[model samples]
Target chain A: MKLRVKYSGQLRTATRCGEEDVGWSPDRTLAELIAHLAERHAAGRPHLLSDSGAIRPSLLIAINDAAVMANEANATRLRDGDVVWLLPPIAGG
Target chain B: MEDTGQRSELDAAERNRYEWQLWVPDFGEAGQRRLKEATVLVSRIGGVGGTAALQLAAAGIGKLILAHGGELRLNDLNRQLLMTTDWIGKPRVESARRRLRELNPHVEIETIEANIDEGNAADLIGRADLVVSAAPLFAERLAMNRAAVQLGKPLVDCAMYDLEGRLTTVLPGRTPCLACLYPEPPPHWKREFPVFSAVSSTVGSLAAMEAIKVLAGFGEPLASRLLVFDLRNPCFETLPLRRRPDCPVCGPISRPAP
Candidate 1:
């Protein structure tokens, strides 16, 4: 499946993935996709995952336009032309 | 219709001050009167809240309750527009009040020099018809969310980092509160992050507009939707937000009584 991943905030600078689509195998879960992105973009690994190799709790994953909660993210599957937004919490006022 | 006449009449000065915006369709003198009668609370009047409060005052909101702690510092000048260089050592809320009052003397201005916390969240939020949660911490944001949910008031949540910003409107039982989006603060979250006045003000202005729409009953509001802007790529996306049925803050309140 082809997924278009949009990196938000500091993640964009860290990942260097701008306006490009990433390819992944069928039935790839949101967590696996994030892990794959972390692997591909080594600089963003720390931001995307924790030392325990889990998708960081702070990372917000939106499939299409609906936000997937942290607990449900691993079970959520991606399909062709899925648009995923990797939003980090931006607390600065 | 019973109280329409009593509620919709705007004074001569108000009519003149909001002349340009009064031209907006569905938001004529009646909308202006709604704005004149509304009270909005903007917590932590810094980059985001300060701009939100300024726009609210410009729109002639009846009362603005501005809350923020600490004296201004040189570092805050880049984004805290309400704080001028001369007022560096002064309290931020006082400075914000002075500037907002200068802009719209007819609008009532109230200031509190303390940031939102458990001690004062209920009292502060209870006093306003609407709330703009521009505080820089999740704890403060969650406090505001809880208070808003409990009080059944609308809240506009705004935040920014570097060139990105996100906004969502919470209508208590109707839309998702901040806690529903992030059950707990992100592990990587920090108290301070990269911020630009341009980005903060952009979100702040949008938040203020959301508040105006909610108060004046004109344009469509961002309720149950999250709008994210990435200024680096100049991209804007509005995503649908769902209320978490299990959300501790809003879930129980939305449940039907047995």
Candidate 2:
């Protein structure tokens, strides 16, 4: 399956992947896709996941314009031509 | 001061003050009066909230409660337009009040030289017809969310970092609250982040518009939707937000006592 990933806020600079097209195997969870991306980009690994390999709480993942809750990301499956948004929370007022 | 709920008819001067906006279709003297009768609370008068408050005042909001602590610094000049150089060492709320009052003296302005917290969030939010949560900390945002939900007041959440900004409007039980989006503060979120004045102010102005629309029933607001703008990519996305059934703040409240 092919997916388009976009990073927002500091994640764009940290990941150096403003928007990219990636190929993934079928039936992979959103977490797996994140882990895959983290492995490929050394700079983005720490920003995308914690030491325990859990998705960072501050990062918001939206699949096709629907935000997936942190607790549900591990179980949410991805599909072909899906657009994933990696959004880090912007805390500044 | 509390809203006395007594609204006098719009005088000729008041009508002239909002002449341009009054011409907006479906938003005539009635909409202007609604603005004059509404009270809004803006948290942390920084880049985002300062712009939001300024727009609210310019639109003739009846009352504004500005909450923020600490003195302004020279570094805040880039985006915090409400702060003047002379007021650099003064409390942020004071600068915000000065600028906002100068824009529209008819709008009642109240200042709180303290940040929003669990202790005072309820009281501050309860007094307003709506809230604009532009605080830099999720702790403050969540506090405002809880208070706004409990009080059943509308809240406009605005945030910015780097060249990116996002805004969402919360309508208590009808829409998702801040807590519904992030059940807990993102562990990676820090107090300081990169931000441009343009981005923050852009989001701030949009937030003010959302609040005005909600308060005056002028247009369709972004209820239950998050609008994210990435100035770097120059892209804008509006994602639908869902209310969590298990949302601790807004969920399980059932209905307000009739």
Candidate 3:
């Protein structure tokens, strides 16, 4: 399946693009999606997941317009045509 | 005539002020009447605060107390709707009070011509059912949050930049306070940022809507969540937030509620 990923603010600068189309598998989650991109796009980047495979606090992840709470596993089981948005905690007034 | 709650007794003519809202499913004459009884304090009527306060007053939130210290300047007209070109040299609170009272005479308007701070935050927040943080600086924002937390008042924080806006509702100790989400004011958060009047209005309206929902028992109040908007790309997002264990104002204190 295919999933569309979106980015904004300062993260867009680092990702070097606002959005991308990526291949997906039903078995995967948001953490898997970013892992795939981080590996494919840029090597040596700090992994998004912890050693225990949890989303790191520095990065904020959203699935289909909802922010992931710290306690919840942001990596939900993926479905075809899912929309994902990634944004780091950027500072603003 | 029923008390309508506040001293501002609803006359036969003023009853028509809420005809549309009163006809809604759950918000009938009683709910509309409930709104007329609630009091909201808007801290520092500026870009975001002025717009939110205006909406609350126009929506007939019975009593509104506005706190703002600065005098209006030509530069403030960009996003401040309460100030007009004619009011440039006047104090901001005066213009904000005048515009708010003019919108609905039924709304009892109170003015606090002082900036909210650690010293006086509680007294101003004490009188209101809900509070709006429209003040520019985070020092003021932090003060408002602390006051709201101390009083256990639901706080609606409206903020905008460039063409984007973000809103979040703080349910005192139940949800995350401003300090939880932002541990401290960011170094880059300057007083003036790129903002459009429409964006400020948009955030302000949403803030007022949240206050309305909290006050009248309407829809979801966005409790414990942060709603961020990017009008440039028009993306609306909500992030679930939990109280930080070490947030200064909202952090862990080994004491119970006073």
Candidate 4:
């Protein structure tokens, strides 16, 4: 269950890699994936989390192409083949 | 059917002009007619807004009002489709008005050369049925949101940050207003961030499509959700958005007026 993860805009600069293929997991949540990626890749720890360890409002998390509540980052369950995308503030028209 | 001569010929011309849309059954006579009679305001001729304006013009929107200011620069060409090297240092709105007219003579191009501020937002937006908030910054988007709420007009707000774009439809109190989603304008540094034309155009086209849907009364409106497009990986996402009861712009309005 490999997942294709993508980062866009300035978030790319922070993540270091625009694209990543992550090992598959069953019932993994978005937060777990980001944490895993931070450790696997040379990417710096996600600044998406605020000092309080909450997802920052300035960024957005989407599974397969839909936005999800940040507080539910880890709550939004992911399936074996799901694709989750993370993007930090750049512009939204 | 004796008078069918002129009517039949007109239908052929119309079909030829709108052949692409005509293929969509729902967008037949009524939709095409509505599009022909609709007026949309693209508040800025910047990256996303400019591209949206161009699509509107090419798609045969009956009337388009482009509001923008300042002289063009070489840098603006990256996403500002409305200008060319030949028109550098010239006024944006004026040049865009001419180019759009060339694309489709039928599109009535109007221009408001001044910037949209709290002072003139109402008057600027009052002329159109719907507003497209593609302004360069959040302050402009916020001002347009207020004007739309006051008029009960729908606003297609698009913003770009690098290769990512976020689009939200604001119907006053129906969904979250710009202020509800963003309490403040995120500071002027938001502009300091780099933007690519590819991302700008992506957001711009989506904004135009939303405006078309609203004008013609077809399809589902992104009323209570935000559409996020990340060109870096080509992912599209929509998140349900709730109206902020305390939103400064439309929080306490008697009704959304949408």
Q: Best candidate per lDDT, number?
A: 2
User: How many times do residue backbones clash in model 4?
Assistant: 15
In terms of TM-score, the best-performing candidate is 2
TM-score of chain A of each: 0.89, 0.91, 0.74, 0.76
Residues B181-248 of candidate 4: C-alpha lDDT, one tens digit per residue: 66555332355556788888888998998988887777888887888776766778677675556667
Tens-digit per-residue lDDT, B1-258, candidate 1: 122566557768878988999899998877888887888999999999999999999999989999999999999999998888999898999999999989999889999989999889999899999999999888999999999999999999999988889999998888888888877776666777788899999999999999999998878888888898888878898988777788889998764343
Selected candidate, larger lDDT, 1 vs 4: 1
Candidate 4 per-residue lDDT, tens place, A22-59, comes to 88677777777776755564443444554455556545
Q: Give the TM-score comparing model 1 with the true structure, all chains together.
A: 0.92
Candidate 1 positional error at A27, Å? 3.8
CA lDDT of every candidate: 0.86, 0.87, 0.74, 0.74
Error of 1 at B42 (Å): 0.4
Ranking, DockQ, top scorer first: 2, 1, 4, 3
Show where candidate 1 strays beyond 4 Å.
Answer: A18-20, A42-47, A56-58, B1-9, B255-258
Chain A, model 3: TM: 0.74
Model 2's number of clashes is 1
lDDT of 2 by residue, A1-93 (tens): 899998876678787768999998668889899989889887777778888998886577899988887678889998899999988666789
Better of 2 and 3 by DockQ: 2
Tens-place lDDT digits, model 3, residues B1-258: 134455545567677887777677876766667778888999878777888888888778888889888688998888789898999888898898888777888788888888889998998898888888887777888888888988888999887666656788988767778877655454434676667788888888899889988888878888877787887767887767666676777665333354
| Residue-level lDDT for B104 in candidate 1 | 91
Candidate with better DockQ, 1 vs 2 = 2
Stretches of model 2 off by over 4 angstroms after superposition: B1-6, B255-258
